[model samples]
Target chain A: MAKQDRAIRTRQTILEAAAVVFERQGYQAATITEILKVAGVTKGALYFHFESKEELALGVFDAQEPPEQVPPQPLKLQELVDTGLWFIHRLRTNLLTRAGVRLSMDQQAHTLDRRGPFLRWREMLLSLLDQARENGELLPHVDTSESADLIMGAFTGIQMVSQTLSDYADLEERYISMQRHVLPSLAVPSVLAALDLSPGRTERITAELAAVQD
Target chain B: MAKQDRAIRTRQTILEAAAVVFERQGYQAATITEILKVAGVTKGALYFHFESKEELALGVFDAQEPPEQVPPQPLKLQELVDTGLWFIHRLRTNLLTRAGVRLSMDQQAHTLDRRGPFLRWREMLLSLLDQARENGELLPHVDTSESADLIMGAFTGIQMVSQTLSDYADLEERYISMQRHVLPSLAVPSVLAALDLSPGRTERITAELAAVQD
Candidate 1:
């Protein structure tokens, strides 16, 4: 049991190091030597966990998905906002998520499949939208699937623009701006008014979730 | 004069070939040897024009901008849509624009300045949006700058999703869907009613612009 625990810890250390190198140097420019140096792990250990660079990237990509889901809300729209905010929070604060996102968007990463994150996001959004619609939070013409695509695209584009403009320092503000501009077309007036998409919402939600878990 | 004309033609040929290769193989995987083979030009000729792959990518990036502006519309909002639709049209049909767009979004392209297209696009959209607001086509509360960011982000995101899902075969419909979902938040009810954002709008607009030029 002790040896198994150590092995898991070692694997995690390597993944974290890979994320750092991949984020800084990009997937194509990132190298095993650099990752191994940063990780302080033997090549044998690295290879034991991940067969190749592609496998390591896949591991990093999988690590980007938040381990815990956002706690559900009574108003599905608020839940939707929470999900977006939480993702923004992750992008802002988490290196693993940022590196995973960078790798997913890297055009030079030809060997690794990049579609997983986008598809997963769209699915998650689509499910939430369907719930929002059933709860009477959506406007009459709001197609949940179309709105899913719109939200996914808008979120991605805003993040890219924010990254370019401010290195994601302004991502929360951008998210609020996105919600302000986009939600009007998808949600009812009452739902939109009730939604808490404020800049500090993520921090508050994270604290609430932490308190609940504790 | 003939010698200069040939030189110009050769340069154009190399750029076009580079665009094709870059689009097919992405920026990193794409090689000058492949471009040279496609262009059927000597190493001297290629070197004379573009000193390196990065310079060649820059050339392709500059070439992505539409040479002729969209013919103005009565409503600046219409003009804005026309610009977007025209870009969508180019993305669907033109390899140079597609390659450049791909390169602009390429994360591994460290040597190239990818911000030009995004900044230029925002500038163009911002100008049109400012005009639309001046003409009272916008909602009283709409901030043109925020709307510009929203529009840019949404447009980029939609294009990426569409490209991922369909390789851009369904981009026109996706563009129309985006306009439908997004326009209401920015434009006044009367302006929204008057706007022409239907499918096949790009084809009609392109024909009108071509006829006007003729």
Candidate 2:
């Protein structure tokens, strides 16, 4: 068990190192030797976990799993907003998330499944929207799947613009603005009125989650 | 004048060659030598037109100038929709535009000004929105700059998604859907009702433009 724990730690260290390199230099330009230098690990140790750079990129991409715990909310629509807000916050601060998104967008760089993250995000949003629909939150004309597609596409676009314009410093504000513009078309009038789609909601939610974890 | 025309043709040939290579391999992996080979031009000829690969990328970016001529419209809102529709048609058939957008999104690949195309697009949209406002086509609360940002961001996102999902086969449809969703918020109800945001609008506009040019 102790040996297994140590192996896990080493693997995590390697993944983080690769994420930093991939995020900085992109997949085609990043080298295993650079990752080794950043990780402070022997080539043997690095190869023991990830056989190739593609595997390392996949590892980084997979690291961006949806948060394991979501604080319960009174309304599913609020939860949806929280989900986006929380991700914007994470995308701003988390190198892994940023690298994952960057790799996914760099479709010509690798043979790995570039669409995985997008599909996963779509599924997650669809599930949430399904719940919102069940809760009578969606407009009568709203199609959850289409809305999920629009939300994912719009979010990806906004993030790209933010990255180009401000390196994501303005991500929270832009994401909130996006939600403000888009949600009115998706949610019923009453639900849209009740939902809190404000900037800094992610920070407050993060604090709440941290307090709960404590 | 003959010498100038030859120079112009040579430059266009190199730009097309570079666009093809960049579209295939992206910015980092694409090589000037490969571009020269494809263009069937001497290195001196290529250098006479573009100094370096970065300059070549910028040249491709600059090639995406808005159409010089727009058919006059009674409503600026219709003109705005026609602008996007015309772009969708060009983006479908134009390799230079494709290469420009690809390179712009490949943030780490080159030192070229990646934001030039986006900022230009935003400016063009802002001007159109300003015209729409002057014509009283916009909502009372509509901010032209913000609406321009939203339109640009949303269009980028929808295009990316369409590229990923269908290799742009459905781009026209997706772009039309995006405008349908977004324009209602910016335009007044009467104008929105009057606007034709249909999927086949691009083909019709293309035919009309060709007829006018002829």
Candidate 3:
């Protein structure tokens, strides 16, 4: 392999291995020896890639980027919001969320009070939320940063809450409910009305949602 | 100690130790050994008092049960719903949410699928929602079980999302947004009128919430 290609391959190997070990034993319990075993890499190779366990953990953390941050253009507003919304819906339904969550907690041990990949994700979300708000896509009263935090927070809460609830429960229904019912608070009534939702999608879903309570 | 007194003391000691460890190390890192040491108890004593870590964790979960759950009550309908809403609101500001999350993740790894304290909280919420539906407090269309799950899920999502976003950020506004805008979908226009909200408690809070959105 060329030198640059070899470096990229090795980096991928270490992260893939670390993800496995972190998933299995958690961050505190997982040893470097085990990661190397999983990755099928030598300790020398591991050291060349990462100086410490924390660095490796961070590398793994960097692998995640929620789909909501995709460039906010060339699509219906619903697609933009729904794409982000849809990822979280799948996040609840998928195994990746479980792995992602396990790995997140594992690395959280060494995490600091501020400044990290976690915060970077926040900045990305707020930037998008602010852009949407300024574009008259959100309510005048909705505090951009806090509302962004709330929207993001609700996604995490739903996944964790799902794990605690019954297995084989519906995730998409929860997402629909949030987008339709819960998220309106962060929106202007005009924005809520203006989002890429057709009267048909809203009417059909809300009708079904309405029937459940009745 | 009398039987009741002994039970009370045992619960007290276990929970007290739990609070310390949970607050300091976060939940996943805290072990029975640590809680025992803080409680000045033996392994035997610890195991005798609580069947498992899950039981102990959930047992101490509610440090913030509101005045209503603890209150002198004629048991107004609004209070019950408000209390449920407030429990979720308290969780955002609650320092223990982080520890609870880490602990929940740790608990999840022990089984391919399982229920945790947070899940039980969801169940409790569903129970409340069911009552609300029966009482005609919610809009006719809202499915109590699904709505409960949806609200619970969003609440969970918001907390982690906030932590990931900022330190000392304005989390309280998230709750206000939920209350003001997001909650309206479940209301029947008639019920909204019927809601003779207490000016003393509900009105003052309502005005404050309206201001946040404005």
Candidate 4:
């Protein structure tokens, strides 16, 4: 049992080291030797745990899988978007996992083959979108597949821009406002009316946010 | 004058070589020696043109500055969005610059300091957004600054995804569909009514697109 625990601990150490090295040097530039050195593991130990660099990278990528799609609640389409946007905002701003989002957009995170993780997120999102649309939650005219692509695409793009210009962290507010405009058009009048999107709603969320002060 | 022209041509040749090197091997990985070799210029010529490797990278980045934004003919908000989405579609399909958008998003673009030629675009877009808001083209509640950032962020996002997944190149249609949802709430009813986004309109555009093969 002690030996098994030690082996598990070593695996975690290697993954942590790999994430840092990948973030710092990017995928193409990083070397296994350096990753091994940082992890304080012997080359034999790393090879035992992961046969190749691709295997290690895939492991790291798997660790940062995107959060599950937010389950639908009875709200305006705009509110759904706002709540999703808010979820990402919190994820990106959280001190414990700010680097989490970077793993998706920053080239530093491009060290691994992205087809797997990216596609998984895409699949999950597409399913959620179809579910939302079928539930009559989507406006009659809004195409959920395309909307999913746009939302995910823009999310990645906005995040990429933030990576390039750190000053654009507040770019999320822009997304929120855009959602307010766009979501209303797709939402039935009833859903649109249900959303309390005034400045007071912002105040309430702000207070809720503040309650979780670091 | 003749000697100066020759020198200018030589300088441009060196910069072009630098771009090729940076794009292929990335910024830190591509060396000055490789650039010189590609330029077929001596070290002295390279030094004369660009003082150092960093300066050479800046030269390459400056070359990427999009041709100045043409003051597009005044159009409705939907039309304005169509113009923007069409640009992204063209970037995806255009043979001359198909890969160029991909280069813009990559890490090498950040080689020479943070702000590159793309900074000019933000200011230009901000002005457009201000104009749209002033003309009552957007919802009264919309913040122009946030709205502009939203459009810009989404543009970057769509382009990023399209580059990686060729299946996403159909973004133009989806972009139009997306605008359909986004615009009605934002634009005045008259402005919204004037825009043609019918299914027939899409078939017509597709026909026109087919004519421009290559």
Candidate 5:
């Protein structure tokens, strides 16, 4: 059992090290040698876990699954906002999330499953919006699927723009601006009024996640 | 005069050929040799026009100025919608525009000025929204700059999604859906009612531009 636990820990260390390299140099330019150096793991151990650079890239994408500690709210719209805020927070601080996004958007990453992360994000948003509609938090005519696409699309654009304009230093601000412009049209008046679309919401959510993890 | 005209034509040919290669192979992988072959131009001619591949990519970015034939409208909101539709139409048929967008989004093309096109787009949208606000076509609280960012962001996001999901075949429909969800919040009720948010608007705009060109 002790050996098994150490092996899992070694695998995680290697993945995190690879993510840092991928984030800095992108998928094509990133090398396993650098990852091995950063991870301080033997090449044998690295190859034992990940077969190739492509597999490591896929591992980064798989690591992008949203942290499971988002506490639910009675108001589904608030829950939606929390999801966005939580993601922005993670994207700001987490190398793995940043690498996942970078690899997915990398045009030269031909072998990577670039669409998977996008589809998963849309699915997550759709599920939340569906619940919002059922809770009467959404407007009467709101189509959850279309709304999900719009939200995901708008969020992506804002993030990209922020990256280009500010290297994501302004990501939280840009994200709040996106939600403010978009959420009003999808949520009911009361729900819109009750939702917290503050720029500081990411910090609050980050603290909550950290506390839960601790 | 004849020499000057010939030089202009040669430059145009090189740019078109470069766009084709860049669109197919992206910025980094695209070669000057491929562009020269595609253009059927001499190396001297290509070098006379563009000094390097980076210069060629920048030339592509400069060529992305929006078509000048979007006729003025009584309601600025309609004009804004027309601008977006016209872009989608051009993206559907024009190789240069497609290449410009692809290159701008290319993660590995770090030598290129990725933000120039985005800033230009936002500037164009801001000017129109400024007109819309002056004409009272926009809601009182609509901040033109923020709204411009949102419009540009959403348009980019929708185009990218369309590219991934349908190779841009459904871009017009997706763009219209985006406008329908977004414009209602930006435009005043009267202007929103008066605007044409139909999916076929791109076809109509394309026809209009062709007629003007003829």
Candidate 6:
């Protein structure tokens, strides 16, 4: 049991180090030598975990989705908002999330299939929007799949622009503005009125999640 | 004049070949050797025109913005729509624009500055929105800069998503949906009623521009 735990820990350590290098140097510019050096792991051990750089990038791309779900809200629209806000918060605080998103959105990373994350995000958002429609939170004209696509695409672009401009320092602010603009198009006015789209809400939710985890 | 014309043609040939390779293999993976082979040009000739692969990619990136204007509209909101639709049309028809946009949005292309395209698009949109506001086309609650940012980012994301999903086969449809959702937030009812956000508009504008050029 102890040996198994050690192997798992080592894998996590290597993944983390790979994320840092990939984030800094991008996919093509990043080298396994740098990742190995940063990870401080022997060739045999690193190879045991990941076969190649493509596999490492795929690993990092898979980790963008948070392990824990946000606490549910009465309004499905609010749940969607929470999900987006939580991601923005993680993007600001976690290197793993940032790196995963970077790799997923990197059009130049030709070897690895980057579409998985985008399709997964669309599925998650579509499910939430379907629930919102059932709960009568959405505008009558809203289509769940289309809304999902817009939200996913808009979030991807907004975060990208923020990263380019301020390295994500203004990501939360940009996200808030995005929600204010897009929510009206997706949700009814009454539903929009009750939802919290503030930057402080991200902090509060992060605190709550930490408390629960503890 | 004949010598200058030949030189210009050679330069254009090199740029077009570079764009094809860059579009297919991306910036990092593309090579000058491959570009030269494709261009049927000697190394000396290629070097004479461009200093390096980086400069080649920049040249491609700079060519994304069309050299000609879309011909002004009476309502600037219509002008904004036309600009976007025209870009969507070009992204479909022009390999140079595709390669340029691929480089500009390639987050993995770490050497070249990618912000120029995004910022330029934002500046263009903001200028048009300012005009729309002056024409009483925008809603009173709309902030032009925020609207510009949202429009630019959303367009970026929408096209990217389309590119990933269908290789831009459904881009015009997705772009029309985006304008539908976003325009309501920016334009007043009277203005929104008059603007053309249809896929057909792109074809009509292209035809008009071709006739004008001829």
Off by over 4 Å in 5: A28-40, B1-5, B29-34
Better of 2 and 3 by lDDT: 2
Each candidate structure's TM-score, on Cα atoms with residue i matched to residue i, is 0.90, 0.93, 0.72, 0.77, 0.93, 0.91
Clashing residue pairs in candidate 2 (N, C-alpha, C atoms within 3 angstroms): none
Q: Candidate 2 overall Cα lDDT vs. reference?
A: 0.82
**Separate DockQ for every predicted complex:** 0.54, 0.60, 0.39, 0.51, 0.58, 0.55
Instruction: Return the candidate ranking by DockQ, descending.
Output: 2, 5, 6, 1, 4, 3
lDDT of 4 by residue, B144-183 (tens): 6665566666666766666556545556665665567666
| Native interface contacts kept by each candidate, as a fraction | 0.59, 0.46, 0.64, 0.64, 0.49, 0.52
TM-score of 6: 0.91
User: Which portions of model 1 show Cα errors greater than 4 Å?
Assistant: A24-37, A66-68, B24-38, B42-54, B66-68
Q: Select the stronger candidate by DockQ from 1 and 2.
A: 2
Which digits, one per residue and each the tens of the lDDT, describe model 5 over residues A58-177?
Answer: 888876765556877898888888887888777877888887877777766656667887888899889999998889888888889988888877777777778877888877777777
Candidate 5, after superposition: displacement of residue A107 in Å? 1.5
| Model 3 chain B worst lDDT window (10 residues) | B66-75
Q: Candidate 6 local accuracy as lDDT?
A: 0.84
Tens-place lDDT per residue, model 5, B1-214, is 6999999999988999999888777686688999999999999999988999989998888766655579788987888889888888778777888888878787667666788888889999999999999998888888899888888887888877778767788778777777878887788888889999876777787887789889
Candidate 3 structure quality by residue, lDDT tens digits, A1-214 = 7999998998888888887777666666678989899899889999998998888777766655554433335223354455555454444544444455546644245452223544555566677676776576765676766655555666556655655554426444555666677556566666567665432443443354347547
lDDT of 4 by residue, A1-214 (tens): 6999999999888877877776666667778999998899999889989998777777776655554433335553534554555555554555223333444444433445555655665665566667667667667777676666666766666666666776446555655565666667656677667765543444455455567553
The interface root-mean-square deviation of each model, in the order shown, is: 2.0, 1.6, 3.7, 2.9, 1.8, 1.7
Ranking by TM-score: 2, 5, 6, 1, 4, 3
Please give the lDDT score for candidate 1.
0.83
Error of 5 at B124 (Å): 0.6
Clashing pairs in 5: none
Global Cα RMSD, each model: 2.7, 2.1, 8.2, 5.2, 2.2, 2.5
List where candidate 2 sits over 4 angstroms from the true fold.
B68-70
